[model samples]
Target: MNPRRKKRLLFASVLIGGVAAIASLLLFALNSNLDLFFTPTEVVQGREETGLMPEVGQRIRVGGMVVEGSVDRDPNSLKIAFDIADSGPAITVLYDGMLPDLFREGQGIVAQGTLIEPHVLEASEVLAKHDENYMPPEIAEAMGESHNKMEYSKGSY
Candidate 1:
């Protein structure tokens, strides 16, 4: 091959390799920071992918309806604890921060943090649904079949 063609081929290969490296690095960063969202039931039952309860201290997300009558707040501190339940199971969450204005029992929410135990999560952040009829899609999917949304909606739950 000609000298000019060889140089061009080498440059092209370098460019492609550089692009691939950057893409892989980006993917690695995203995967590391991305927390898998789980419902209380899934956490209780254990993850299908791993076939085991998440290790204690591994960061993850848990979302579900805030169990009715489970809210407890401290009189003098920001500490608040509540149970979030899906269709079949519930997990207790402990958070010490100003809760969202919309946070309440019977509402859908997501808690981001690490599992403190098999059925407890230490939440670093809590996210409530933005509006009525706006449950998170992951929670909705997890709650189907077993969870009776209508019962909860009718003011009975």
Candidate 2:
């Protein structure tokens, strides 16, 4: 209860409070912007578990190989749709913008968007493998590590 001690205590309390507030704000911003990554199989499982589509549309990234010959594009418009699949399952993605030059069937890709429907993603951005032999690191690691094990089903071209 001494005067000088009281001021020191007050300063310490204020400093700690400020730090906590700032930390809380930073965490809030990060959580709001954080995007979770999910594979097509996981997405399907989620839908099955919830039994309802359209959970919180927190931005998500799905990485997989573009199913061979699944690209569908309108003749006169930028709209395009493709199926992206891993060894497990596939999800259809619809995009309305110019695609990356490297995008093609049987290529690795990661799409960022919202799953607006059952097993469908309305992608806002799409990224394709950069080169003939190169894939995104995530896809590469996943394919390399789990190709055989992740093959939940076959015949999904």
Candidate 3:
């Protein structure tokens, strides 16, 4: 090969390699920081399409209706535990902070936390629905069909 052509080729190769390296790094960063959403049923039985269960210690958001009579409070402290379900098996969530004012039994909520067990989550934050008619889109979609039959409240559907 001519010396000039070889020099140009080497420069081009280095540039392309650098670009690829940067792109791969960015993708890795995004994947690691992502917080996947799941329902209580999905956590216990795995997702419907992917059939993949979340790994322990992975950060995630779980949305569902707070199981009636599942809220247990520590009277002495802010710690509390509750079960959430979506027309299927329920998962218990543990939190150590004040809950949202709107939070209550039979209400829709999304809890952000890390999975500590197959059916347990160590929640860092819990958000309740703003109103009676509002349900998170993800939860609404996940609970379709079965949600209509499993009444969380009387005359509310």
As a whole number from 0 to 100, the lDDT of residue 82 in candidate 2 is: 94
Candidate 2 vs 3: which has more TM-score: 3
Instruction: Find the number of clashing residue pairs for candidate 3.
Output: 0
Report the lDDT tens digits of candidate 3 across residue range 1-157.
Answer: 9999999999999999999999999999999989999999999999879888999999999999998899999999999999999978999999999899999888889999999988999999999999877787899999896655655435563
**Candidate 1 local lDDT, 94-129, one digit each (tens):** 999989999988888999998998899999999998
Cα deviation in Å at residue 92, candidate 2? 1.3
TM-score for candidate 3: 0.91
For candidate 3, the 10 contiguous residues with the lowest summed lDDT are 148-157
Quantify all predictions' global Cα lDDT against the true fold: 0.87, 0.78, 0.91
Rank all candidate structures by their lDDT, best first, as comma-separated numbers: 3, 1, 2
> Which 10-residue span in candidate 1 carries the lowest summed lDDT?
148-157
Against the hidden reference, what TM-scores do the models get?
0.76, 0.78, 0.91
List the candidates ranked by TM-score, beginning with the highest.
Answer: 3, 2, 1
For residue 84, what is the lDDT in candidate 2? 88
Question: In candidate 1, how many Å is residue 78 off?
Answer: 0.8
lDDT of model 3, residue 18: 100
Q: Candidate 2, TM-score vs. the true structure?
A: 0.78
